[model samples]
Target: MAEKIDRQEVQHVANLAKLSFDDQALSKITPQLEEIIGLFTDLQKVDTDGVEPMYSPTTEVNVMREDKGIRSNQREALLKNAPDTQDGLIKVPAIIDESEDGDK
Candidate 1:
């Protein structure tokens, strides 16, 4: 079993991860962290004499279809489906924050 951790150690770990935890949150998380460490400590005692390590979850076979060239829709027909067009190309509105610019 893992030893009980204090606030200082939890704060240090939070700093290492670039995270911030207030006093109430730290108090709650400390015991949960201790329990997780104890579980890992228990797992360390398991014997695996001849077990092979797994790198992936699945035994993968060819899952993708062969990439082959095919004919596609014509440009003019595609342009006709667009909501707005300019100079034979699709035209979209500017992605600006109008509210930040004092515009309602």
Candidate 2:
């Protein structure tokens, strides 16, 4: 059975999503929404008794490497490219206001 999506339901969904649609747009989108619901209803009739549930569509497995401590002496080389540095560390301008207490 095809489910019908009324203008009120569409408007309610729009309001939930913080969207505003005029009468023309609402009329146009209602049919599309109904069609999508009908497609889902059709999908409910499919049989998948022996099908395995998939977390992802692809069959790729993640290969993990053993954690080995290897240090590089590239700090001095990287520090040379920095635009601003302080006490052997990169310095950036403060973005947040620390003076403002949690009152706001």
Per-residue lDDT of model 2, residues 1-104, tens digit only = 66678999999999999998999999899999998888889876879789887778877789888889789989989999999999999999887777665757
* lDDT score, candidate 2: 0.88
TM-score of each: 0.44, 0.44
User: lDDT per prediction?
Assistant: 0.85, 0.88
Best by lDDT: 2
Error of 1 at 17 (Å): 2.2
lDDT of 1 by residue, 1-104 (tens): 45567788889999999999998999899888887877878866779789898878887776887798777868899999999999999999888867678754
| Candidate 2 local lDDT, residue 77 | 92
**Which residue pairs overlap in candidate 2's backbone?**
none
Stretches of candidate 1 exceeding 4 Å from the true structure: 1-4, 49-52, 58-104
